[model samples]
Target: MSDIEVIVGRIGRAHGIRGEVFVDVRTDEPGRRFAPGGTLRMGDKRRPATLASVRWNRGKLIVSFAEAPDRTAVEQLTGELLYDHVPEAELPSEKDEYFDRHLVGLVVRDHTGAERGTVSEVLHLPAQDVLQLDVDGEERLVPFVSALVPTVDVAGGFLQLADVDGLLEDVE
Candidate 1:
């Protein structure tokens, strides 16, 4: 919704009769979704649906939109999203490291610095997050760990990784 300040989490399913939902967070940090008393916008760029209640469920966080006070209200948002506009001053980036958002649109290159493809999306797996890329008419899944992605220039919006050793062997 709106600009989606930031996706705090998502509504998984209806909880109990009172009102409850679940969130499968996609952030690099596991606990980023359950930041208590946060707000989420549904759609558009104006007033987002504020969150009234939030909790964790089976490692996933459950959030109740501030605007919804009943089970029916929560059910209506089962498939929608939650967002927050985190200020720049609040970013927790570290040296030689950048958030996954910065790598959304960048060219992936080989060790020789050859164009392999363009990154399309970033996936967060329980083990590790991977980059989904489209290269030379083929899709490539590159691991997003430090060993693979050794360098990330956030301002430049590009990523450089070590030679993917047999990384594509299984993909073949």
Candidate 2:
């Protein structure tokens, strides 16, 4: 398999007997995130277990990993970051749309060709996805949209951000 970028779901805690884990999903696309018989990771450790079973109950996703043979083993993985590798073919196409993960590591720039910083992470909010930028020991949130972030050249590993008024002046 190709080395696809890891997409993180929420960290999970071991729940109940039977080696079940309660995972708080982070991705909007749960079907791909929790596809039955797929692989997932905890923290930096890549788990190569087939997903045995998964179900939603009480607003928490309960997943049974093939490697977690018993409740004791499940308890050890509590509160670990879960990562999944999703294939590009599984994603649907929308004109001019892109996955948020594709923006990571892209250099942020202003319209005047001023260098901003590299994107550290992407934050999903109710209204829009925010690009977390590490700018000189500080973090800034740039609203992910066409108006503010008008251009992105993933090939060049940089993006041109529209100068939002007061956006860079303050941190929220």
- Per candidate, the number of residue pairs that clash is 10, 0
Top-scoring candidate (lDDT): 2
Each model's lDDT? 0.67, 0.76
Q: Estimate the TM-score of every prediction.
A: 0.76, 0.70
lDDT of 1 by residue, 1-172 (tens): 2332556555678878777777667555535545557555664443467667766657667666667777898887776765666564354545555555667888777677776677888887778778988777677788888888887766665677687675433434
Where's the lowest-lDDT run of ten residues in candidate 2?
88-97
lDDT of 2 by residue, 1-172 (tens): 4556555565477777898888777776677778778887766666565578888897778888888867898788777778776674444354565566667888888788788788888888879888898777689888888998888887688888886775565635
> How many pairs of residues in model 1 come into backbone collision?
10
